[model samples]
Target chain A: MKEFSLIDTYFRDVSFQRKDVLLGIGDDCAITQIPAGQALATTTDTLVSGVHFLPDADPKAIAQKAIAVNLSDLAAMGAEPAWLSLSLSLPNVDENWLKAFSEGFKELTEYYSIQLIGGDTVQGPLAITITAQGFVAADQALKRSGAKPGDFVYVTGTLGDAGLGLDILQDHTDVDNAEHKAYLLNRLHYPSPRVFAGTSLRRVANACIDISDGLLADIKHILKASQCGACLQLDKLPLSSAMVDSVDQDSAFHYALSSGDDYELLFTVSEEQKSSVDRVLACSNVPATCIGQINGAVGKVDLKFNDESYAYSQTGFEHFNSGESSNKHRNNAKRA
Target chain B: MKEFSLIDTYFRDVSFQRKDVLLGIGDDCAITQIPAGQALATTTDTLVSGVHFLPDADPKAIAQKAIAVNLSDLAAMGAEPAWLSLSLSLPNVDENWLKAFSEGFKELTEYYSIQLIGGDTVQGPLAITITAQGFVAADQALKRSGAKPGDFVYVTGTLGDAGLGLDILQDHTDVDNAEHKAYLLNRLHYPSPRVFAGTSLRRVANACIDISDGLLADIKHILKASQCGACLQLDKLPLSSAMVDSVDQDSAFHYALSSGDDYELLFTVSEEQKSSVDRVLACSNVPATCIGQINGAVGKVDLKFNDESYAYSQTGFEHFNSGESSNKHRNNAKRA
Candidate 1:
């Protein structure tokens, strides 16, 4: 079948039964109903072959990661996922690849109750762009600008596993532990969007952001937006047992701080809200730890271990920072 | 500058003063307020280097066409354009290119009262995926399924100019009339989205579609969805004087029926509603001509040229039809 036919056959019927979706596929435009007094939230992410993922990566993994990363944006805003539009650029028609990709895309979207509303298929280098839309009540939506000077910083889930996973995939690092390799690889390929934790933090998190460009880089966005600084305790950084087993402590710390693609929530909460934030995270059954505090020195971020400041090898991932060799060093391992 | 910094420098301050957009750029997700009792209309389109346009094509024209095609979809649905998100993948960073592209993007969006709410830019091959959102009343959106057996079919503006433009670009056709070449090239690169005509025809048009994939192929979509057929009068198809002067009558008809990217609205109205439709079109100051009628015979489409039948050499553009040599033939003059 042709590209259009392949979409009709595999993707046209994968609607997730969203009540808010008035129209799905097969139209010039998809129709959606946003509830009154609510604001619709939207985000888009494009995953390109060789840049965002391996050109020979599994189709299922590619589709899942694409959807998950976009969903993570909605999660950072404390919004409820409702619908998505996909634009797929392909080098050629491959039915089996498309089937696996759609299945993986459907799997996460179904779990989030997001209907696949519309899509455009074209011939080109392989790239998948997904626009995910959700709803958040007015200013009740979380923003990076909401962080306060006295707020405590927190992150959901363990970090560095996905970064280590990329290292493993690129054959840059070797590990003898089979279980560690498997878990790290899963973290790299199928990092879960922290939706439950993000939504719950709407009442607690003063500001929120999803860690796609590493903790050091993403946290700086919150600081810049809120016009504040942060003091982080490096020893408090959370690392999965699998990541700890795969790499040394220093290597693990570097990955946790500078690696991208973790898809975890990094947020700040007021001193008064910290207890409630902890309570909510516990209730959501997501592991979270306080690792820093927002400070008065605007736009400054300091990382230390027990009051001893340590020089870092790199800051974080930035797509346009190719001039600085350190950024290349960061991308090499994180994007392996 | 970093990727996020580049976005902040180039894209953040373009709020467009949209009152409904409570939040735009800088956040994880943009926030929009949809009025009560209204449905949000969304469509996505992806344009790739080499496939959609030459890699060396003007960035301004590329940006304009990208937004225009998506707006054309909204126009087909009779929705009022509102918000849009852009996902841009670039092979490398070039400031002059980005500046020209943004200027072109801002030009059309400013006139249409649409807001650029959010975007994601990454390093990769050149491809742009834009998702446009609009608003329509509940159950009032125009659909291909609404056509009836007795509906009179009409098309807005001229057909086949863009196809001729592509022919001119590829050096496939040579004409002495420089004026005609200029006209055709403009039509190809900047075909106006029929926002005024489409919205006005909401009450009169039983069904509506934008001509992206030629009259014959696009009209078939209407027929397929409405479970009907159509009989088109080949002689009545609206063609510019330049088009008629540049090509023979048969060639003009072939491009009108088989080429793509006209971006005109092809709609059907009941016979009784034809006068009203005409009146609406007149008030909107857009030229439209009746050329056919819907029929009761399901899926049967017949074209007649002054009482004689004609066979088409091509259908429409399908991305992955290249395995068949005929697909390359279709792409030749249309995509050149």
Candidate 2:
């Protein structure tokens, strides 16, 4: 069928356009009015099938992840989630699949008090895209470009749990311990977004970023944007007992330092405000660990382990690398 | 690689959680403060490879169309385009592909003067999602429900050209003539957005929609929302000379009424305001034709053809139906 015809059959519902919607689906554009005093924060993301998720992965997980990841972006910016639009590409329209997907999407949306403002759904291989919008007061935002030399670097919660979870899922890691297995699985299946902590950190964080990339790599982003470097104390890396118990101390350290997907916040604060930072994090009821200190050195990140410094070869995850598919890495090593 | 690693490599760089960005990627949410007296009109669309376009379709066109379609949504709302976020899913991190896509994206962004703010990128089937933001004056935006009985139904530009172009691309019909074929192809390749017309209509037209779906189906949305019906004068339907020369009158009528993807503005204005509309259309330099009138009848659309009134079959394009593939329709019949 023609593109327009396809849109009409599957998408053109009057319900898609609401009373609050100044314009909707059929137009060259849709218009909206934001209430005064709200600054608009916009974001977009594309999730490819097979690349972003398993082809047969649960639709609910997929939907939840889509929003969660986007919401994480808003959190980093200290913005409040307001509305979102979704675009889906499917091989075909499976009613059961759509119902499940929408249910999962609505669940997270309602929980967060976000509205499904507008989006387009179409046919193709399974790909989902979402554009999310949030509101925040003007000037109250966290950015990667504001870190200065001598700032104290901090991270919320533990790092590398998601990465460890991924390692566990890639192979049959014989974790006879059920609790440990469940913990790892939970990390993989559901990630807690540090929204509250993020909101609270707006005033204190000189620079902030979420650790979707490994902490080292993500810190590089802040350093590059802020034009500084950092020296992380290896012993200070925050890791869970479960993660440490699953592997050797060295491997656990490696994971905590380099494995990605903790979804925790890595931020820098001025040295004079270190106590205030600690107090704010405590008041907000989230773990905040000081891992390092920013320095004036350019393009260098030092890891001080024991009395000597260790040089790392790999720079965290690179999208098309062939050296170690997590699955393959699991088969070669028995660390977990 | 795990999903988190994929996101970091490809998507993290997209966010700039700066002051204007109140919230940005990596948080549980992002928020924005809307400027005073501006209402936020938002819309989203998803495009999947092989479903929305041929797998080999130009990346530039795909990128351009992705943003253009969302902009079309903003236009439908009679809102001015502002910011856009993109979610992309790709199979591989092919630098060449990304470079081309970004180039295309940047081109249209410059043309439309919209900013690429933030979003996530992940692995999956080639899927693209974009959420676009636009602004309209508070309390003065147009809506579909505003159409009233006795309002003159109007459509800007010609219709059905996109459908015919699709037919040619699918090789469903032999394009014995070149000029007519070029016109059709151009319509499909570069569908112009009627932003000026739509925004202008906000001041005068009772309601409006963009023709992404066929005329009959789209009009149904207005009718259902307005609790009214319409009687379209088939002969008054706008058709290009090329379309008329290529197809018979009846078939041409079918294309004009049911063929979608025109991306032109279909709107309504009060009969008492006809002269004013004419003057406005002339001043705005957009060609428009009055094709019908809204009636008190609830949820019905009738067509006047050859002095005989009949109900439109209400069939054109749909995503789920199997009988009318663009290729099949074009190959099976020389309808246009």
Candidate 3:
């Protein structure tokens, strides 16, 4: 089939006219008319087969997570998603795969109210690249450099669940319990994007970041940007009940501190405004935990456990540093 | 070395402080404070090794073209580029490659006055994705649907040089010329982004699009959006001197009208604005040519050569439908 005919039959439904979108798909470029008082926040992410995802993973999950992770970036900026472009490279066009993928993509786009603007489709190993564009008011957007020394550090939702989910998926540990399996599977397959929680914190949080690279690593980004250090108390770290029940206390601590893929928000609030944050999150039914406090600008990260300070291993994920392709191995072992 | 340290060492130098950029690289997300009176335009493109480019192509040229192609999308919307985010996937952490890539990237960013923003780096097959953001006044951004019947169409620079350059590089064509080869190579390796021409067109052109997917296919997009049709004068199609000198005139026509990757702006302006466009291009040293005009809604693309309508066999490129991998027999025959 020709490219035009294929697009007309299958991908044409992806086009829709919107007042904000001056031009949708089927153009050399997509154009939008941003309102007078709004600013645009943009981000791009590429998920390569056998690199970022498993080669034979569920297309629905892949599509959802591809857009979800990028939305997480916009969430960190406290922006409202408006438009996106996709560049999908596949070995071949499989009808069933495209249907499932589009279904997954359309659902998330509708949930976020983001329009599919323009995109390019190509032939290659399965690779999906999504660029998400979001909007924010001129003075209302959040940033990573706004945290001060006296700010109270906060996190939305529990950490380490997604990482533990990966462990369960890989069968690294045998879980005979059905509910435990289901919880781990959900965490691995459909990690939540903290857009609502992030938007709510726009006026309250000093600085915000999405935790894709674990609590310690992601929080360090806020520290580096704000030119501050942090003291995270181990006892205050939040972990899922399934994670805590399945693993030993020390293992739970390690997972909570260093496990990645939990798409939650880590933010800092002023010490005086801590109660307001608690009240806001409680009303919204989103869990917000005060894990630590920003300290002096000494360029250090400290963790305290059981009234003792010990040097914890500071490893989350490092791409291309080691010979092993860790993500690929983890995914392949699941199939095995 | 870990991913964080590698990013710090290689990507640390891509820093700039602009008032409009509220935040930049090294943050969870880059935040921009768009000027009050402007609308934001955004786009993303992914170029994979051995797919969009020759696997052995220079890293400098790859970096340059990656930014240039995305900037071309902004220009199509009559937007001026302000920021870019790069998601790079490499097989290894090669210091020399990173230095070269950064240097090439920096040159283009500085030339365009674009700031580096937040992105991710991972280990995978060599692929580079960039999301570019630009700004224009709220009502001044161009769209594909603004062209009206009786409007004169125009294109900047010669077309098909990039496609012909690919032919020469692959040894499909035996042209024994040196300077001509250099020119074609430059066109393919690093096509200029027509920013100045696009900015100037904001005052005169009714609609505009950048030519990435050949004239016939791309012009169809404009026609579809504008609810109009076009009768392209094939005889008036512009061809580079080397193109005509190297191939027969009829073949040159095919290359110019059907070959893709020109990266020049194609636009429509009412007849009354011809003199203004001419004057602007003359003063700015930007080449502009008129080859066609809009017609009534006919729902088809037509071409005329010597007052006789003609049809060509080839359309623009469709990456998935191209049968590139399946054509291994043809490649083998050529090699033998």
Candidate 4:
């Protein structure tokens, strides 16, 4: 297949179309209009076959994860997803794989009402790089640097389920329940980015980021940027019933604290805005739980369990460590 | 060499700063404000080692080519370069290689006055995916679909030097002149995307595209989109002194007709606007030579040499043919 034919066959007629997209797909550059008083949020993520996903992973799942991860970045900034440019490098053309991938892409793009505007289809190793662009009101963007010392740190949805899901796939842990196994695999393969909650928290949340790096490690981003620290309540960390039932408390907490890829919004709300955040989240039907508090102890993180200090040591996934060590570390968290 | 430190060390302190960039690297997403009345033009390109360039190519050259090619697409759309999001996948971390690569990146971004807003660095087979965004006036942006039957086709600068340069590098062709060899190699390694010529042609040209897939193949994109045909004057093709001096007439023409990566703007100007285009290009000090004319024969291209019909039988690079065939085909017009 020629590059143009490959794009036309699989990506040309995506179901979603947006008014803001002035020109799409075939042009030298895709043209898009940003609404008045809005800023564009741009993010790029690359997924390599062996490094980011197993070689045998489903094309549909890989496609969904690629789009989901970038959209999750936009959601972190309280942006409304608008368009995506995909650069797909394939070792060879496979029609069935392309079809499944396109279907997966269409599903999320339609659900999010975002258009696939432009991209490159190249001949190379199996990898996908997606640059997602979105719009947020000029003054309403959520940034990691906005947290104040008195702010309450909160997270939408449960954490660590995706990590456990990855473990299940790698056979690092076993799930006897067929339904549990399926759910865990789904969690690992398909994550729901907190787009709705993100927009709702735009002006309300003091700071925000999606949990792609684990609760403990990602919160440090907020601390580093805002010049504050956090005290996280171990008992309050939201653990899904699936996770709790599948693993012991220590293992579940470890995954929640150090493992990544949850795609839930981790944000901060001040005392005065807490009620409004709760009300807005409730209206959006997304559960958000306060699990920590920001403090003046810059760059420090304290863990407490039942009002007593808890000692824990583990780090989230870091790329470029020796492949052996990095892979071992990533097998616990698993996506970059 | 963790991901964060790698980014901070190499990409964090890029000198160019744009006032419209509200947030840059280190965030989940980079935020930038699009100027009102301008549509954002976005393009993505991926360069994989051993495919786009030799595996042993200089890191600096590879980096520059990666950014320049994407910018070339923006230029084709007559957009003013603005920002870039880069996704880099590397097999390992080499500080010296990264320093040279970042230096090359810094040179282009600063020269273009564009900002590196965000990107991803991953551990995988070497590949660089850059998504470049620029701005074009909503009504003045050039499109490939606007050529009329009487429009004159023009191309800025020379063609096929890059292809010849590739041949020299691969030892398929030999260049005796030291200066010519250096010039040809430089052309291949450091293509100057016609940014000035492109922006100058915005209101003057009816249709435009950058020559990346050989003039014969790329002009067909305009022909297809405009529902028109073209009669290319083969003898009139602008050949760089380096290209003409290094190869025989037929070989030079073959590369000109079928080789890719010239990064020159190929555009069409109506008869009435031709003088204005000439005047504008002259003011920009960029040589744009008329090489063809658009006609009514939809989707067809006729070649002429000194008013005699010229028969040419070769296609541009197409991905997914057998590796042996495709690689052989690409040797003439590589870079996807």
Candidate 5:
């Protein structure tokens, strides 16, 4: 089939039926209404086939991850998901691939109640770029530059499972248990963006970010922006049971600390609002745990292990590093 | 350089300083404030290497054209350009190329007073996907499905210069005058999005669409959505003097009818609003020309030359076409 027809068959009519969308697909541009006294938050992320995921990975998984990561950006800003525009490039027209991708996109958009406003599909190498937009109150949008010295650093859900999942998928790690393997793989392939948790923290958390680039690397973004330091207690690091079962302590620690793609919310709350944040997360789907404390020492990330200080060689993923990712697939399949 | 640092060094500080942007780059998401009673009009377009332009095309031209096309979509919707997010995928780091691209992007953003909110940069095949957001009064946004049968069809600027420019660039056409060649080439490389013309038409136009995919192809989009037909006068097509001097009459007409990449606005105006639209256009930089009439006949595009019926073999560009566009580079390069 042709490109336009392919879009008509797969991408059209896939909206989640958002009421704020005045016009959807097939227009010059999509039209949406923003609520009064609210600010619009938008984020764009592009996931390349080889760089971001396995070339042979499932289309549905790719679609879900693509949307999730962009949505995670919104969540980081304490924005409620609203509308999205997807720009997809493929080598050729594959009906089955498109079908699976649409299903995955439809599922996530429905879950988030975000309508797919408009997009463009082209003939090229595989890549998915999604621009996800959301709304936050004028005064309630979370920012990274608001972390105070007295703030308690907290993270929602566990970290490193998705990064480990990548290792397992690439067969670089010896993960014996199938259940643990499946759980980690799911975490890697279908991460749930911390949407509700972010909205809940809007008025409670002083600063926020979603952990996509490992705990250390991403937290540094907060520190750099907020001009504060952090003391992370490694012992308090949250880990999924599957992560613990599938890897050794050192590997698990490495994954949780330096590996990436967790999609969990990492936020800071001042001493005054710590109780309020705790109350908010008590009813959230994923549990929240205090893992560190912000300090006056700017740009410092002091890692503590059983009251002793330590450091690691690597922080997180960097696209232009001379070294390759240890999680790269061993028998990497050729792109279809 | 790392991806984040690359973005900071090159893409950061490229803003038009629009007051609506609350927060821009360096955050998880860019925040912008939309005024009360305004609807957000958004459009996304991707220009791929060898697909949208020559593989070795100037980075500045690529950046400018990419931004311009997206802005044209907003203009078609009668939305004033407000903010933008650019997702750029590059094959590798080229500092010279990056500098030129930023200059091109910055130039246009400054011209339209559109702020660069935020975006993503990645290592992949060379492609630029820009999502442009604009605002229009809730009741004044133009749509493609509003034209009546009696509306007079009009188009802003000349129709075929940019289209023929591609042919000239590819050595498919020739002109004796360097000035003519340069003019046509400039149109292709730096086509202006009719932002002000569109805003003026918000109340005057019954339906509107941008002429990106040729006059016939894009105008048909309006007719199809509005459930009407059109009669286009071939003789009345506004061809640049350079275009006429550069190519044969038949080829120029064909380019005007079937070639793409002219970012002019095609809108329909009712009899009552025709005078107002003319008044608005009389003092404009680019002139608008009345070229056709909408009809009750559905999905029909009857062409006439000096009051005689005519037909063309092709409609417009289909991305998945078997034939390569002439604008494609001689030694077609592979995707990175």
Candidate 6:
């Protein structure tokens, strides 16, 4: 099929439409009206086959993961996603694959109340690039540089589930229980972006980042940006039942600290705003655990387990780094 | 080097800083304030290594082409370029190549007064996906659907030079004059997007589109969107001296009508607005030629040379179509 017809068949009649969109697809450029008194938050992400995801993964799962990862960036910024521009490069035309991928895109777009404004479909090796834009009120965005020395570190949802899921899929780790395997796989394929939790934390949280590069590496982003250190209580790290049931304590802690692709929000809250943060997260119905405290040591992150200092040495995923053995299973590095 | 350091070394210190940009790199999402009373115009385009440009093409030229093509879409919509999000996938990090690429990017972004907002760099085959956003007054942006039956079709600058350049590069065509060869090669490597001409024709033109897929194919987009037809004066198509000197009349016309990558503006103006359009183009210092007149025949395009019916039978570039032998030299299909 021709590129135009391929797009027309699948992406033309997307279910969600926004009034703010002055012009949608089928144009030289999509025109959108950004709401007054709000700032625009934009991010771009690329998912390469065999690097970000298994080459033979289901089309639906690939589509979902692509959109989810971009939305996760918006969520980390405390922005409500409004528009997405997708550049899809494919090896060849596959009608069934396109149908499933479009269905997956349609589902997430409708659920998020965002519209696919414009994009380009090219002929190349399989890869997907999405640039997501959303609205955040002026001076109200959650940033990594906002943390204070006395702030408490928190995370929404559990960490390392997606990493474990990747391991299970890669056959590096195995789970005998069918339900556990399915749960882990689902977590890997379809991550919740924590949109509500993020927007709720806009005024409450001091600093924020999404954990795509593991808790240890990602929290240091906050420290480096905010110019503060952190003391993480390893025992306090939240582990999903699937993770805890499938792995031993050491493995669970290691994955939780150093593995990537969790898509959970890692943020900080000032001491005075702790109650408010708790209330806001409670209203959003996403469990958030305070696992650490920001300190004055400047970029140093100390780990403590059972009241004694703990030493864990494993770096997060970084593209072009040859040292990480599990880099293939992790989401390739994304700067924004 | 790691991904963060790679981005920091090249992209972080860009010189163009816009006041409307609240936050740029290093954030989960870049924040920008859209000017009041203006709408956002967004478009995305991806260029693969082997398909869009020669795999061994200079890194500087590749970067320039990637940015220019996207800005061409913005210009087609009569939007003033503002921000860009780039997704760059590469096989590996070559510091020298990246330096040249980043320099090319810096030159264009500064020239256009646009800022690089946010993006992702991944480890994959060489490809670039750029999402460009600009601004136009609400309801003032030109569109493909605005042409009337009596409108005069016009095109800016010259066509076919880029195509001839590609043919010469691929050894399919030859030019003996050193200056002409250099000119054609430069045309292929650095086709200028008609930014000034497009913005100037905004209120005067009835409809507009950028000619990337040859004048013949791109004009059909206007025809399809406006529900009208056109009779193109083949003899009136502007051709660069380099193109005319290097090829026969028939070959020049074939390249002008069938080959792609011109990046010139193809637009329509009503009879009453013809003088105004001429004055606008003159002020912008860009030559525009009246090439045709829209007719009521509905999607049927007629070609005329020397006031006689021209029997030209060839199609434009379309991805996944096996019929076109020159598709490899053409820029792959881009919907937006």
Q: Which model, 1 or 3, shows the larger DockQ?
A: 1
For candidate 4, the per-residue lDDT at A120 reads 97
Model 1 stretches with alpha carbons more than 4 Å out:
A323-336, B323-336
Give a tens-digit lDDT track for model 4, residues B295-326.
Answer: 85899999999999988887665666555431
lDDT of 6 by residue, A254-302 (tens): 7788888899999999889998877888877999999989995999999
Give per-model TM-scores: 0.96, 0.89, 0.91, 0.97, 0.96, 0.97
Tens digits of per-residue lDDT for model 4 on A218-279? 99899999999999999999988777777777777888887778899999999999888778
User: DockQ rank, highest first?
Assistant: 6, 1, 4, 5, 3, 2
On TM-score, the stronger of 5 and 6 is 6
lDDT (C-alpha) at residue A279 in model 2: 73
Please report the candidate that would top DockQ against the real structure: 6
DockQ, candidate 3, comes to 0.53
Task: In model 5, state the lDDT of residue A247.
Answer: 65
* TM-score of chain A considered alone, across all candidate predictions: 0.95, 0.86, 0.92, 0.96, 0.95, 0.96
Tell me the tens digit of each residue's lDDT in model 2 across A101-127: 777876787677766655666767777
Each model's DockQ score: 0.83, 0.47, 0.53, 0.83, 0.79, 0.86
> How much is A44 displaced in model 6, in angstroms?
0.3
Which pairs, if any, clash in model 3? none
Give the range of the ten consecutive residues with the poorest summed lDDT in model 5 chain A. Answer: A327-336
lDDT of candidate 1 over B1-336, digit per residue (tens): 668877877766553669999889889999999988889999999999987888988888999899999999999999989998999898888989988888888888888989999989998888889999999996779998999988899999999888878877877776568787789899988889998888898888989999998888899889999999999999999998778887777778877887788999999998788889778888768899999889858887788888677666578766677555222442322111
lDDT of 3 by residue, A132-170 (tens): 877777577788888899898888888877777777766
Q: Lowest summed lDDT over 10 consecutive residues: which window, candidate 3 chain A?
A: A327-336
Weakest lDDT window of 10 consecutive positions for candidate 1 chain B: B327-336
Model 5 residue runs over 4 Å out of place are A326-336, B324-336
How much does candidate 3 score in TM-score? 0.91
lDDT of 6 by residue, B1-336 (tens): 989888889888654889998999898999998888999999999999998998899989999999999999999999999999889998999999899999999999999899998899999999999999999996889999999988999999888888888877887767888898899899899989888787888889889999998888899999999999999998999998887777777777888898889999999999999988778888779899999899958889899999899897787778877745663434321111
- Tens digit per residue, CA lDDT, model 5, A26-80: 8898999998888999999999999899899999999999999998999999999
The segments of candidate 4 whose C-alpha lies over 4 angstroms from its true place after superposition are: A324-336, B324-336
Higher-TM-score candidate of 3 and 4: 4
